[model samples]
Target: MRRNPERRAALVDAAIEVLARDGARGLTFRAVDAEAGVPAGTASNYFAKRDELFTQAGGRIYERLQPDATTLAGTREGPRDAARVTELLREIVGRISAFRTGYLALLELRLEATRRPELRDVLTERVRADVEANVAHHLESGLPGDATSVRLLYLALNWLIVERLTLPGVFSEEDVRRLVADAVERVLPAVTRPDGPGPS
Candidate 1:
């Protein structure tokens, strides 16, 4: 027998809250049960194991990321003005900043994945698909279909943004944005050119 739909959702939400507040290490079924106003056994029943709970939490993050990726998919630029790529970058930095703890949870999940080949495979595929999907959206005109380069670019940008938080006082958001935009303009000149001229 299943719990009420509302209760199930409540438990899941509690799980996320626990992750966000205390990280994966603190995500005990008892903690979630209390947060969800359910009995411990109910939490156990819903998530058979700690691994299951962790996987579910990871899925929640994946669910949120899907819309962001889909919205920007298959375009050389996102919905924001190309001139405002810096602004978009800043926004991304801010959004990620708000989820620092959640990001840690994801990192923990990744380590767990290494021990579980099935989970590792699942994560690998998701990561590849995500990069490919986003790269397609962020294409510049005349860009070579170099899948390897595209993958590297995605990895580079992802790491840079992750560092933005970890590396304190490195650069302001505007500075980082300008640096990224300028680099893109230089590297992908043909695609990023204004109606005027390419990088001189």
Candidate 2:
């Protein structure tokens, strides 16, 4: 197969859009080529197999949906106190909210993975790596939690993201903010609280 990094990247992005708009069932090479405004069969040339296209699309969605540097710097700075952790969680929610399409595409990919064992393995590893990275980041930042805590937080945030994106008005913005605050407090209790022992 030919190797054109930029073109392949464009195809992946287009695939993400297609996945978000049309779901996995509608994701075809022809659809991707149309979405990318490239000649027919362009996506097929870049990704000969459907699974390959889906894998690349999943990776591309993660790349496009990552939090910005400002948010990362805030998380890295200072102690990971309850308030700080809440703020960080809020920032993450904001970023995910901003890139709702990419996250939606990722969610679609997760569902699609169930039907294909090879794709399932690839997606599982990708998600596992992401969780591991979050665990490491929490450790480096002195976040008030272990890998288990990080994993819980990851699952909670992902659920919230899906709910907010897919269900729209199910939860107001303030409701989500409060949910994040409560989640952080529960998962990562403050190191020291005047009242002693954090919320249960």
Candidate 3:
């Protein structure tokens, strides 16, 4: 296998696009090569097996989807209340929806995982770690939610993302945003105020 990190990353990204468009059955070395506009067999050189490519693509998609430092820092700047949580959920939807191909490809990886135990294990671990990280973040940031609330939000918001990416017409953009706020309200305790700015 080749040792060029950039080339390997490019191949994995191309594989993500192919998986999103064609699913696991259609992801071939030649297909990835064409998608990447590299020489034939280039992907095969980097990934010895199709399963290896699938695993790399799965991780690569999440890497591309993760928020940058600015986005993370912004989450901590505002009030730590239910409304702030709602805005965070909205940001989650918007961020994931913006990377349509990556999210769609992730869905494909989930389906493929059903038949491939190796792939399933990797995905399971990565997703579990992600959930734990969210829980930690919620707790540390003084967000108006417990661990369960964060987990519930994670579940609801992910399905919302799926609907937005796969069947966008089902919900208008405004409706999706509303649903995010609704989901937050459902899982989080109401943070009511006396109709004025919070006291010092």
Candidate 4:
């Protein structure tokens, strides 16, 4: 019999919640079944292997990241106005404070996947897509050369936000916002440097 897609998705979301709240060691099929409000066999039926379940769980986590990522994605089609870039930068910083653990869980899953090649491959694809989307957005907006620098900016900003969450009283969300915005401003000019004088 075909399983309901919604129900299957619910189970996958539940697994991510469990993984985030309890960590990988604490995650179990039983807990996911409980969280999803379904029979234990139901989750098993949808995901016959633990790796398969974790894979779906990782996908759900990435889906949660997309909305804010799309804020960055929007700037790709054209040059981002200053206000738009600031707003996007702040939103990205805010997501770090709001979903710190979820982000950390994603990091943990990435590390765990190193020993598990299949899971690693899945996550690598998602990460590549995310970075590419952002990179494309930056490039389309007339940002030139130094793809590595732009990619590094993306990586550094994300790590900086994540680092703030791991500390207490070291920085506030506002501080992160300012820092990220400053970093973006420094990087933006280089990417959008003039090839020649053009109409502003």
List candidate 4 segments past 4 Å from native.
68-84, 143-146, 189-200
Model 4 weakest lDDT span, ten residues long: 191-200
Identify the candidate with maximal TM-score: 3
- Candidate 1 has an lDDT of 0.62
lDDT of 2 by residue, 1-200 (tens): 66999999998999988999999998999999999999998888888798898898888877777667786777788755677777878888888878877888888898988888877887888888888988889878876767788899899998998999999789999999999988976776644366645422
The lDDT ranking, best first, is 3, 2, 4, 1
Alpha-carbon lDDT of model 3: 0.87
Q: Worst 10-residue stretch by lDDT in candidate 3?
A: 191-200
In order, the Cα lDDT scores of the candidates are 0.62, 0.83, 0.87, 0.70
lDDT of 4 at 114: 80
- Prediction 4 TM-score vs. true: 0.79
- C-alpha RMSD values across all candidates: 4.7, 2.3, 2.8, 3.8
How many clashing residue pairs are found in candidate 4? 1
Q: Write the per-residue lDDT of candidate 3 for residues 45-97, one digit (tens) a residue.
A: 89889999889988888789889999998989888778888888898889988
Candidate 1's residue-wise lDDT over 162-182, tens digit each? 666567478776667777666
Clashing pairs in 1: 75-137
